[model samples]
Target: MTFVPSPSPPAVRQPGATALFCLPGAGASAGLFAGWDEDLPATIEAFALEPAGHGLRTDEEPHTDLDTLLADLMDAVRPYAGRPLALLGHSFGAVLAFELALRLEREGTPVRHVFPVAARAAAVRTGSPPGREPTDEELKARLRALGGTPAPVLDDEEMFALLLPALRADFELTDAYRYRAGDLLDCPVTAFAGADDTVVPWASVKAWGACTRGRFTVHRVPGGHFFPFAHRSARADLLRTLAQELDRRPGTAPRRPDTPEHG
Candidate 1:
């Protein structure tokens, strides 16, 4: 991670009245949100975060830790802080979202709300994760269980080799990642999980409630770990509902006058 800000896709309006900054899962590109479609209401704008080494700039190295990852993404999102901002991060991306919200609050950048989908609450490190990277076969098995990597990517040695670094980097990041839990988030937090996601058990996902001081709600949508794959309708409904709720309860918008803008 050379501390380069990742670029995001063009802004799309959501159906509601707020703006959404979305972060994707590890080894996944911004393209993962394509299924979201144009379901966003005009009052809301949606922007999906595209980390380096995926999608448009697939050649760059992947970032495996919070410090570098959030610093880079904050650079990408700082410019849009002028209005009420909401975070929507899934899986490992959720970890980044929690950090981003905390950092923004510390810097007086009013991140009004956050939606950490498919991730456990940051406060609870119920178990210690492996401190090392996985073997090649182990990596393949992990990827297989997630159900997102294309078969070609798994079967093609050259392609798999190219994508391996980022994928494993993500795993290492998740494993060694520690949440030095401190101040509770002032913004409301919501967690979503796939009903059948065996990887991140619902019990663990529900634990996300401990991360926020304002309010927390956990919902289980139908499907598996990559349920976002088949539940476009459910996702749209959930997103819309969440955005509507936030709009009605519009918390503090960015009040900082000196915060530097980045893109």
Candidate 2:
């Protein structure tokens, strides 16, 4: 895959506050996290990490290699190490979130927690076999099944064509991803899944516990692959509960500059 330098969305940083970094699913961008700030209290600042070749960066080519894409994201996030950080990823984004969390922990960055939604556990092998590529029609059909894509966009030939490259690149990244075994994370992990999601089952979501030595919890929401938006009320309550839970945890405030930032 060709490396394309895309414009990054503005960083979300608030002095002396916890920051929540979100990763969107395949073929999606930071726009996936619309209205997150309103759902949570002021103490927690939410920012979405927009993947390259999508969202406002649509003109650029997407990175097909997981490592390259992650390296760029790591650099963007490294500066925020002094703050209490938590990660939230949905679907394919979940995989990215898991890998990012591990990298941060290994580098002695303090990661408060990780939330993997609508995805399998890190130990679970995901993606297509090497060199196998799905056709555009097949990809469209899969997207239709997932119900995340709008009907009009899928039906519009011109728009769909424009969306194909980034979509395909994301497929390559996820389908080609190979899991590397590593130590369980020291921070807590919360996994969420759609009870009716045919693609990723509830059992797969529960398996996220194996990736973390810290507290592990899982909640199944109603609807298909995109349950969060489908059931807004339920999702709001869940997110509000998450915020409260994080608030209750001791020492969630941003670390002092003089204090060690690692666990």
Candidate 3:
């Protein structure tokens, strides 16, 4: 994945601002986060993460293997390591954010917090058998049910055709993922769920608490699975919560040697 800076530059980037990395869900591009930085506090700088075969890198092949994807992401995000970092990912991106958080913590960079929106816990499996691939039509039906993708795009043959490969690859990558237990994160975790989302249950959203030893919280926002972008109130609620977290923990903190038990 590659980090794409927000299009509109902030008037003045506060000194020692927290780097807020945003990741999009399957079949979505970093464009989902466009204009987020403008809405966020000056203390937070938002950067959208663009995966292979998405957005500006449309020519690149999408990654099917988790390890390979993470390795590439690690390299891509290394330059911003020392600063206070926070990750916010939606759905499929939420799982990726969790895994990336683990890797960064292991490498001695302390992540301030993790916000997994509209996604199940990392340890929870999707229940799809390995090698089970959904047909293009099935994928379209699923998208329609989810309500994130626009109706016109789904109906437009050219646009949907261009998006199909990335969609299929992303689903395959997510399905093949099997969580392996390790040390719980020291950073706090706040999982967001849509009040009306049916794709992921409340239990699954709360289960993210087990992934972190620090504070754990779950906030139910307005809208369904794609609440992060689809609903204005939901987006405002997220930015507000994020601002509070950044205010509480100013600048970067050193990584602690001891790991606390999962809450």
Q: Model 3: which residue pairs collide?
A: none
Q: Which stretches of model 3 miss by more than 4 angstroms? A: 1-12, 249-263
The sequence of per-residue lDDT tens digits that candidate 1 reaches over residues 1-263 is 01124344334343334557777777777777774636766666667777867676677887766578778788887866776778888887887788888888888888767887777667765435665556888988888887778898899989888878778877777767676766578887777787777778777777777777766666777776776656677667666766665765545433221111111
Q: Report the lDDT tens digits of candidate 2 across residue range 72-101.
A: 778867767888988889898988888899
Counting clashing residue pairs in each candidate, in order, gives 5, 1, 0
Residue 191's lDDT within candidate 1 is 76
Lowest summed-lDDT stretch of 10 residues in model 2?
A: 254-263
lDDT of 3 by residue, 114-210 (tens): 9899998887764467665678899898778867889999999899999988888888887777767764788888788877889989778888877
Error of 2 at 10 (Å): 6.5
User: Which segments of candidate 2 are over 4 A away from where they belong?
Assistant: 1-14, 250-263
At residue 203, give the lDDT of candidate 3.
78
Cα RMSD to native, each candidate?
7.7, 7.2, 5.4
Give the TM-score (vs. native) of candidate 1.
0.84
